[model samples]
Target: MSNEPDQQSETTTKTNKPSIINVAVAVIHHKDKYLLGFRNAAQHQGNLYEFVGGKIEPNEHAEQALIREVAEETGILLNDNTIVKLGRLHHDYGDKQVSLQVYKIELTVEQYEQHKYCEKGLEGQALTWVSKSQLLAGEYHLPAANKTILEWLKLPSTIVITYPLTHFEAQSNPKGAWLKYHQEKLASDSWVYIRLKDSDSESVAEQLMKDRPDILVILPNDNEQYLDDKHFSTTGDTKTTQQVVAKHLTHSTLIQLFDEIGSSTASIQSLPKDYPLIVSCHDIASIKAANQLAKARLNHNLPPIIGAFLSPVLATQTHPDTPPLGWKAWADLAELADMPIIGLGGLSPTMAEKVIMYGGIGVAGIRQFHQ
Candidate 1:
């Protein structure tokens, strides 16, 4: 056999530092605008705008600490229901290290203004609301702590892939079912990968999303829209194309991006600085490649691979003989990832809660999620 690395081998690295100081950060959002703070000249990383948050006290859970801090910092009250963990971040300032337990905070339109009414000089900064487009394009200089927030935007909670050519039994027609899924699912603001059996089906899925253009749709089979395919269009202005997540790209494509660079980590430095770039990984090498790419982006001060899907979590009809990464192994793997990791292969939506308990963002599947 050739000397190719074991595709299944584990090469991804996760750092655990007990001394890294924990900081609870908030990404307070209302409507489509995010609440940001302009760091005053007196503070650390002064003059740079970033998320408003503070240190976590002893014996305090991240959510509780975030609630207390936000109240103290902005005079805004955030309850448990309005908060969700985005991910974590470890940043070294040379003098000391900080481990940020980041969370996404939501509030009503009226209450969103509560931040502005706060006592002057709250947390020694001025708070302002900014749109995601400006923030993602690097129009503003936000502190490094905001990186993971952008990463989580790429790592959606539930990623539903489109079904094959055969029509669903529950519905009389296939198009009807697809429309229903879009109507019910897309209404909540989520991401879906339209990997139809052929171009016609993928085209239909694209048209269905025309009305609700806000939802993210990934087209894996269409060459023109597929970023990894030949004749790939890099049309950032097109809403349909902008949400595209480059999937299952070839080794050559990555090599070309970083040219002669053996380190996958180094290659990541070439990705878009503010937006996320995603690729599918089946083995340890690809995962490590993604890890390197993420590190490389961070190294160059850019947005890197936000997350990845660990495939074949359980054996299926297509690959019944392939040993799966069982629940514990999958969960353990999730724990190591700094970004949200989604489980795939024979996974069902019902199992998503367990996946979260084990550290994953959620589960994705082809037939299991009734693709």
Candidate 2:
């Protein structure tokens, strides 16, 4: 995690009382130049160039607020289709904490200046198209505004989709039906599973190339009786799934799975340095798994280990146990596992919010269908 403090924390943590409702800003751009405006007031006035946006009202959504603010300040009518939610920033400004839902809008330079010099200029004094590189050079007036712009530049352009790899088949009766259903629901970037057959562990690499293609697959020990490996083979499958995956999907997207810490550590040792691994744990086994892997220093070499299915309260025939811990447990476990964690198990978009709030990478769901 970056050591820099979140700007929203300054405003949010100052007073014990709950802060006002959310506000936001949109970084409108054209080519390499950004649209910046000078605040007319004293608090952030005097040549201060900031992204055009402001406080969201009682009944307004963040996106709606952004549109209204932009138009109100610069007389530019922004359509809903022009907006894209990049991410959010939470900052504390001494007395109040503000959650800034950041967005990006692309518009032509001519359109921008038309609004800037419009007869109905409402709030800002001037508007200028500044190159992103120029903004990075620290010529901006407001320090916080500069920081926000810099942070936006650092964020990835595409939203990263992190998913879990589970042991499932496309032909195992009810299980197969469920697997196929979920597989179809997966986002293009989401992770999927591939079980290695017992007969030819060596051919696992070849099979992956032919069937699953670029998906990250879980290779379990073949035990014939253990639920995970009942259908797959475990003997002489010494080459880690990560190794096999690395060989086939070198430049493609693929993440391997390690059921327990012992296997994870061993797999890390056997696989290439760059092969991604998904560390899984469900039940008491996770404690030993994480501890052993950490002890072996395998966690140090591998990429972030996404948390697999974990439920604090197990569902029973009679009734459900406690409510799901959501990302709290996953966050805690990820800290111990020494890797970034993505919440799995029964999760929804609402649950995913909690996962991100608690410092998780993202959320993956089996029951939820992808649009």
Candidate 3:
């Protein structure tokens, strides 16, 4: 849980100037593997399987740097039409700091070689296509760079619209929506929108497996309204909602849902309990209920819970001027809570990738489920 900024010092003894500057790199992919190049005998000599592209000069933006560096090293002629911006990375090499902007560009085997990979004195070194499994085996050098590449690779190759089903009402058309969403996911075998509901918590939980059994099932919060008929709540004389939800969905699928900050502290007091997955969704409050719950569970020796910032869609209607929690707050909460948090608000798959890049699990939205 280190919060040290990954940046090098500005003053250098040799240059007497800050070595900090902007740099850009391209993560080129052909199919299941990524195109990785070995560093020449010049830079990081033994650093095997590093991403292509290089440093940005003054008066040049990240895109410009990537285009120039790719051509220089691989002789690939890239245009504004070809390069796609993925995201940016900030790292401190101790001697120099760089705000590394990353891009993902696709090329065919013929195009890659036609570019004259080693025409100049750059020295092609060695080029290979690496899969995620091989990358995770720790055979590659540059652990930090490998981690960055892994993060990008985990992202869904195709756009995924994730719907967060917190209630039956949120589904627009519950039965039909679930059927259609499930069929599409099964056909493509690519995307899924988790339905989070508590009505017939057991029956609905069972149907999840019978229907689109492969997709993940997230249980909705035990709000008072939903619990009134279900006979469950965090407080009062009744079985805690968490216990009921856990009992039914534990074996069915990975449970995903937000815990009310205030009640979560008491809800998850036991340790090493068998629960599929947990997400705490406490808003800005004095006690930081989510963090307290995570600490208590961690202290008791339970598994880590996923943290989430709950931005109510109703808030957009009532408080349009209020801004949702940004990446920094989400990252801070995840670090403090010692858990990965997902963005819960008005979000889509494209935005979810952005959230994950900024240190989150992903995005969950109620509106997204209907679509």
Candidate 4:
């Protein structure tokens, strides 16, 4: 068995007062299957399944600790260059609190073959490769903290953010074409963020949900008009809102939310725990505010904002007058975000892989979706 210890004990070693244990978790992916270990019953939150990783030593970089812990536990070496940050999450077990630095690593064919037959980790713990579908369907048990990680994993690498209705008005049947365009996106994509800047935008969004109930729809909740239905429930016979997986709050909306509720217990009480939130962030302050909302939600055992869109990664054709954040500046902004960052503005679906190289989980665009 591996000599490394579980984070539960290390978390409270420093003081009697509550201290957060810093852990580096690796979501090692090979195709659609994820490598996981079954924790021994003796350990904290043990007897359940967990990703391959351990606590971060004091002053050690998260990447360095991750490489060491994964190697020690699984005998699979990780290349820092290939590691992609999937952002972080904090969870309190009441007895102990933990801050997990999540990272993603896609294993090569050879690597997957090398480890496929290993039923037990180097630590003697049983290891299993779970498919994405099984994991999301709750076939395997995992800790509460790992719930948000699953949501991040569920997001596609390419997200389609639709253009406003005005742009589609040139078509002979504007409303019909608009809904059809986004509905067709579900053919190859799992997610679509409908951004309709029209007086009847709400109706259009509702139509899309009714037409494609299985699509993971993200509706724009940037104003008061969109806020009333942000929380969804299936209690009623047929609430179209039940089809939505999340609500997209622009940076302005986030500011207004923070200003009004001021990030207290009220913030957690006001937002629905069942519905996920996504935000638009441009700079450090906005990202910080989004993080505050996420942390507050998680504190209440709720799934936090699943992601944030950091826009203008490159200069756009429609907004040539505005300067882009560029890759370096974009990465800098992404570093401050605690949720998966989706690169928006002048990015194509093909650039999804490139976006991961610079700290974003996916790419979102208006024009690219139409193309």
Distance from true position, residue 272, model 1, in Å? 8.4
Across residues 1-371, which tens digit of lDDT does each residue of candidate 3 receive? 00111234422546655455666777776555666676544343244457776767778887787877777766666773355444444445455455556666767766655643433324444666677567656567642533444444443422233333332356777655654554454424333333344354444433433454344333433332132214323234232232222211121111221243335544454322643234435344411444455445444545334333344322343346767565566555443433344555556546765665555545554444333
Where is the poorest 10-residue window by lDDT in model 1? 1-10
Which prediction has the highest lDDT against the true structure? 4
Provide the clash count, candidate 1. 2
- Per residue, candidate 2 scores C-alpha lDDT tens digits across 1-371 of 00112234433534456464476677777767777766544442344567777787788887788888877777667873355444454444444445656666777667755653343346425667678778767677653523543533532211212222223333455343434544455455334443333343333333432343444444332222121322224543332343232111110111232253334455545433443334445433463454344334322534222233333322322225545554456555544432334455555545655655554445544334254
Over 155-261, each residue of candidate 4 has an lDDT whose tens digit, in order, gives 78877777667767789988888878777755443577766666655556776777777766777663433523543333342556655677778888777666555
Models ranked on TM-score: 4, 1, 3, 2
TM-score of each: 0.59, 0.39, 0.49, 0.90
In model 4, the runs with Cα more than 4 Å from the true position are: 1-9, 13-15, 171-173, 183-186, 227-242, 259-263
Query: Which residue pairs collide, candidate 1?
Result: 163-371, 265-292
Q: Residue 139: error of model 4 in Å?
A: 1.5
> Relative to the true structure, how large is the alpha-carbon lDDT of every model?
0.60, 0.46, 0.46, 0.78
Going through the candidates in the order shown, the clash numbers are 2, 16, 0, 1
Q: What's the distance in Å from true for residue 11, model 3?
A: 8.4
Candidate 1 TM-score versus the reference: 0.59
